[model samples]
Target: MTYCKVCSLGSDHPGIVVDEQRVCNVCRLDMVGDLLVNYRYTQEVFERFQHAGRNELGPYDCLFMYSGGKDSTYMLDKFTTEYGKRVLAWTFDVPFESTHAAENIRLAKERIPATFVVDADDDNIKKMMREVFNRPAPRKPGKYLDEKLPCVSCRTFFVIRAILHAHRNRIPYIALCADPQQILTMESNVREIVRGFYTTFGVGLTDELFRGEIEGLLFAEDDELPEIVFPFIAMRHTYDPDAIVAELKAKGLYASSPMETHCTLFPLLNYYSFTHWDCMFYKLNASSHVRAVKRNGGDGARSTFSLKFPGTLDVLEVEGRLKKVTLRIAKGEGTPQEHEAELVAAFRDLGTTETAARFVARSFLDMPAVAADMGIRLS
Candidate 1:
């Protein structure tokens, strides 16, 4: 039930091993080794290599994964306006997006000197998401994450596509706005599992695919594989959502974008630990928002946050509602069928057919037992 003191990763997470001082096993984040390939890469080394490399590689040759949020939005701003990079901003416009998110993407495209692509693979993506959500959760598998998080799956899909895109375009770099918490959250086990996952596709995500391999990218693009660079990592930037918003507005770029909310398969993994069992861990076990804040420049007050359904229109709002229904089911109580219309509406807004939404709602509520029943056999 204890969360990591250094990062948002909960103690119940498969990747963590708590020590005497209550430090979870990923270096207790002493050197940020839990996140970065080499925990030792300083801002100076990052800067020196990037400067020399940029001199040779020139600008305008990187492909960015843009999601019209504070981090990705500001990332686009930096890539086009500051660096003058000819960024091919790729968006995985799945059905779970807010309407305003789509509009934000357009505004970004209109403003930035970059080619914006909307990979509206909603059918396949939703299919994949449905599969993930419908699957049973397992015990915290050591170094093994449940494959039911649609967020992870979708991002993985985009990463593979980005690799292919960069390869086809002969672009030397693949850029993403990975905050510090994301860096830290990429525990060794998760990285190892992901390394194995992408190897099947014949893609190398970075030179040091495993943690502590060494500091290798960003001085220049490595030819053995296209470099995936985290800008904040190179600059050692802290997580500052407020600052990002302020900066974006100063340039008249963004009006507003929905803040992070769990309207997707996030609940399958996050809420699984909570609603199904008597454990203290639940929807906020490994918080993305908290971790993202820590990743940039700010510290997270984990005790201060709770996951909630932002509104009826938030695409993933069904997740929050279904989770409540699931808890009731676990307690053998009747569900709030009166709210079914609103529940279905939440899903339909995200492009899920009403029938599918109803079916999915039932499935989510039914699957927690599967997760709760998982036998813990630690290695």
Candidate 2:
């Protein structure tokens, strides 16, 4: 029962069977080179993509998902100063966002003076996160179980809330402040967008998550909203992340004081994405010169699920989180050494025992290729 990973279709689907196991429809439809070939845009069409997106105005122009990070600050600057569009900045504060991130958001509110909204239910959110991580998932399926893949569940929740917020507010476009390197313009299509959503652990689309019942009950009575647009798809080519930061800083848009991501899990989750996607692929390719530096002896690897680099966190935080749930589930909180032994035993049961033993061989080798293949990377 070999299945094709690409389309998630099986050999039963019409396709040229590859290795007599699985075959992708797209691959069957065309030869390897045919699919891989890139079409050069014409001079006019290429030039068409050069300009900023059309200035579309309605009751409200856009909704900016502001994390008060340097990137989002720059985006807010561009939307207000450069484009002169009235935008709504929406911030989602999950239970786990760091203290610094919260400060950053407050700073943005003071400086920007834009209409801002914050949505969160702290205790419930934390319970959900704990449940998500503590619930045992099989290592074989490889859904979102990369070792120490921090805060994935929370991020997904925030995105869903953001989407619902945008729709209810009647905002036409949603700006993520995501750099060009994080996601590409071609990936803006519906299918790629959905795939990206899944890769980021947004498994339940809103249509299902809400179950056809709007929570607020007010939005259901209001205007009809169908879709939300990612303005980064158009702006990525025009704006630079570093330059955006610099320009905003010049306008007294300093980094926020109570800054944190939308999730408590970012400090750990970002470790993989920042290194692999940003530093290794994007920076090395010269897409952007944001050199990722692991200043505090951190993991310089990337996340396979949502390819991005990691971020700063106290070593105690990382060790504490990893040893808290994974070890506790394995050892029942006996002792530090006992927890380590139990974790090793659990990994062995999952056929990752060798890698766990190697981690014991070297203190910092906690995550190995087996776990890396699950999504984490160590290099």
Candidate 3:
């Protein structure tokens, strides 16, 4: 089976039957277009979204998932400075987040005067990362062969913690600082399929490695205490990146330069341009992107999936437009020579060339067609 050439919906093979139209069952429902239209709202709808979450008696008006990245900083700035809402900035400081991001969050705390919370246990995060990245395939497993993408796992960990925190604190609003593009790209149906695959991995991996931490999060109480809102969904149409960054910088909200290194594993694996992660991490998370790739309608390329498990990316299956690497080479965006230079530079930062090559190739060449469409822009 193959994807719908027009929309990039994938062929589900034995899992889902595609119709004569070559569109997957999911796409046939037209949910993707519906998702886009419903989420792209007018100013009146935006005001209603904000007003629905208004609470005067709540301890904090909102629990903001603050990545210390630009989007969350912008949201935090507005919540405190303009909107006059008492907000708490929460961070799940994954091990791989740049020190620059750390600096930005630190500065945000001082400038916004918002209470900040961070869950930064390096040892535990590293150990969990080892499970997904270095599973028991010493018989010589491929670089990303745990069959579980690590980047999405990190984001899931953050999300679970935030939900738990909100319930515990009775926060009336839970806000995610994702821009419209990020929110728009998120496919509702694809998430359920991907979650099914990961939940299985979590059960086994957590039993062996985390003992209870992972499962505890999965089973955490889900009492509804707050309404979740994506402020950027409304703001993206008019938000100016430069202006936002400028105001944030002037107010001492971010301490790092915009040009910083980003090799967040999932972004590296999902995008042709690993470097673009710095500019777009908050738009979407790796797990959802991978889910889209495994499902159909992922941009304009045919999506392929793993056979052993239903809804997971099959890394070995790289036929479609994986050759777009050649197109990128023709355009001078990057070449073999430049890749070697990047490898050499990466070695200066204590990473090995083999490790870098494996990841970069996965990021750049494996799913070239989808990568190009998703704004990594190989050509």
Candidate 2 lDDT, tens digit per residue, 253-287? 75532112223343234333233221111211111
Expressed as tens digits, the lDDT of each residue in 105-209 for candidate 1 is 777777777887766655545544444444455455434233324445666655655655555556666676655545433322223434544442233332223
Alpha-carbon local distance difference test for all models: 0.50, 0.43, 0.49
- TM-score, predicted candidate 1 vs. hidden true structure: 0.60
Query: Where is the poorest 10-residue window by lDDT in model 1?
Result: 303-312
Name the lDDT value of residue 336 in candidate 3: 66
Candidate 3 per-residue lDDT over residues 249-336, each given as its tens digit: 7877765433331334433343321121111122122223344554554441321110011233322232222323333443556766
Residue 126's lDDT in candidate 3 = 61
Worst window of 10 by summed lDDT in candidate 2: 279-288
What lDDT score goes with residue 322 in model 3?
A: 30
All models, RMSD in angstroms = 9.8, 12.4, 11.8
lDDT of 3 at 252: 77
Q: Considering only N, C-alpha and C atoms within 3 Å, which residue pairs clash in candidate 3? A: 8-297, 9-296, 9-297, 10-296, 182-283
Q: In lDDT terms, how accurate is model 1?
A: 0.50
The TM-score of predicted model 3 comes to 0.55
